[model samples]
Target: MKPQSMLFTIYGEYVRHYGSEIWIGSLTKLMGEFGLSEPAVRAAISRMLRQGWLESRKVGNRSYYSVSERGKKRLEEAAARIYKVETDVWDGKWCIASYNIPEERRALRDQLRKELGWMGFGMLTTSTWISPNNLSDRVKELTEAHEITEYVEIFTSEHMGWSNPKQLVQKCWDIDEINEKYKSFIDAYREEYEQLSAKMSNGEAVPDSHCFVEKTKLVHQYRKFLFIDPDLPQELLPELWLGKEADELFQNYYQLLNPGAVRFFETVYEAAPSA
Candidate 1:
């Protein structure tokens, strides 16, 4: 990961759990896990501050930063989607969105398409996208935001084609590619879970820095699936879905790593100084 991305990755995992406000010095020390120098880290903070993602304050001679309200809201909304375990149900319906944008507005059309894809809409054609999820309100908001309300329409309907639904899902989404990422997450963290399990069994201590780094990397890597994978319901998935197995591993391994990870973080960012 790039140094700046690494900083926000750490903040999302550590700073959110440890506290809202982070001391600049402590943040620098915590970022040592990523081997980022102070200058690069400082540049990241500066960029975040200018982008209205962070607010800065001074405490005695030290600087502290907190996520801006805008940033906090963004994180909370994203977390809701990223860590969600499963859809309530498939509902046996697909939301179809059809749009007609002027050629002069190709950029806006492309942006709308990108956002639709992110919102779980899969392309059925250049001008149409579909999803098993109910997303009428979301599509309305997008069109309204672009002042193109007249250009788009959505319908909720079931796929009636005899083409095996499983095959259709494959054509719409690169499930195999997404499955590989989940597998990658499993391969990387399964060993960490085993080692941590052994340590806990023997009452061995895990270093704060090691715990912090490992947890951050694990979360960062797993979080990428939010953008690429739609978290489709089980009925739509292939049998023996690796995503399901990978999610089980994620939940299990994350629990194993939490104790030492929290212990280490408390020292770097949350601990009170000794009297």
Candidate 2:
């Protein structure tokens, strides 16, 4: 994960409990467990400030950093996807969008496509995108945000011909590739989950260092699904979706880690030397 992305996980996941502010001292010490150097963390913070994703305040020569309002909104949206589990009953409808952008504004075109993908849209053609989810509001938000109102057309449609929507699923996305990732993620964390679960069940306390490291790794792994999974409805997904199984394991393990993670985080902040 990028240093900045990991910072987001830190701030979004735990720092919010402390009024969304982290002293540079506290942040650097915390990030060390994730193998981030102080200089790297500072550099990432500088970049985030310039990008309007972070804000800072100074108190007697000491600095505290927090997510900017814009970044806070982004983190909240990301959290919705990262933590939510739903058996969305597919309405058998699709939100389709077609757009044309000037070649000169290739950057904007790329931004549009990327945002759509993040919103779980997939390509039907170079110009058209589709999602089983009702993304009309999200697409409109994108158009307005990008100021590309005139370049886009959106419609919601249902299957009407002999061809099945299921047939198009594979072309729009690599379900096989997604499933493999689910398998790998599950395998990677299986033993960790078992041990954590056992510890929690036995009411055994976890070490602060271990808790910090495990929590970071768990959030990092779970956050990846926000980018990789389109979160298609059950009807459109393969039977016995490993993604569902993975979610169960993720949630089950995370619940066990949460208390210890919070304890470790709180203690770390409390240990920071006051300016």
Candidate 3:
């Protein structure tokens, strides 16, 4: 994993729960477990700091880092979706965004496209995007952040076209491809889950370090779905969707690893003079 992405997973899964701060030394030591060098960790931290995703303080000549408010809000939103078991009923209303950024600001326009996709908006046309989720605040935030509010229009409306809702979904997203990705995830983790479950049942003593690594990798892998999965409501999903099954497996596997992982993390976190 890239050091920056790994750091995000670490902060979201571990540091946020324990005072939401860590000494640079503790952070580096923990990251070392994932084969990240101190320099790489430091560089990643610098980028996140510049991006307003992290804040730093000094205590006794040592630097400390914590997620910024923006980072915390982002992590919380991510966690809610990552661990969500039930999809909320769709309101049947669509949140749509349309933009006509000037060609001179092509870079900004491209960035807006990426951000919209990350926010789970699928392209309905060259300049228009749509999602079933209510995203008035998020839409406002992104457009204002990009200083393109005047160039964009936001709307909420029900489908009134000839195509059915599922057809609209098809035109906007590759549901088949998404389902295949979910299948791959289940295939990769199912056996591991079964083995771990058996080990715990047999009173086998698993190593804390192992748990830490497994949980971190599990979360890192699962979190990727946030970008790829628009998290559509059940009404828009296929009858045999694998997303729910994958979520169930993730939750079970995570719970099984939680105690050991937390213990390992705390052991490392408290190892510094003051973390």
Output the number of the lDDT-best candidate.
3
Estimate every model's Cα lDDT from 0 to 1. 0.79, 0.85, 0.91
lDDT: worst 10-residue window of model 1: 266-275
Across 115-152, the per-residue lDDT of candidate 1 in tens digits comes to: 88878878888899988888888888779978998889
Badly placed stretches (over 4 Å) of model 3 are 271-275
Between prediction 2 and prediction 3, the one with superior lDDT is: 3
TM-score for each candidate, following the candidate numbering: 0.82, 0.92, 0.95
Itemize residue pairs with steric clashes in candidate 1: none
* Residue 95 of model 2, lDDT score: 95
Alpha carbon RMSD to native, model 2: 2.6
What digit string (tens of lDDT, one per residue) describes model 3 on residues 195-270?
9999999999999999999999999999998888998998898887898888899999999999999999998894
18: Cα error in model 2, Å: 3.1
Model 1 Cα shift for residue 18 (angstroms): 5.5
The alpha-carbon deviation from the true structure for residue 214 of candidate 3, after best TM-score superposition, in angstroms, is: 0.3
- lDDT of candidate model 1 versus the reference: 0.79
Quick one: best TM-score, which candidate?
Answer: 3
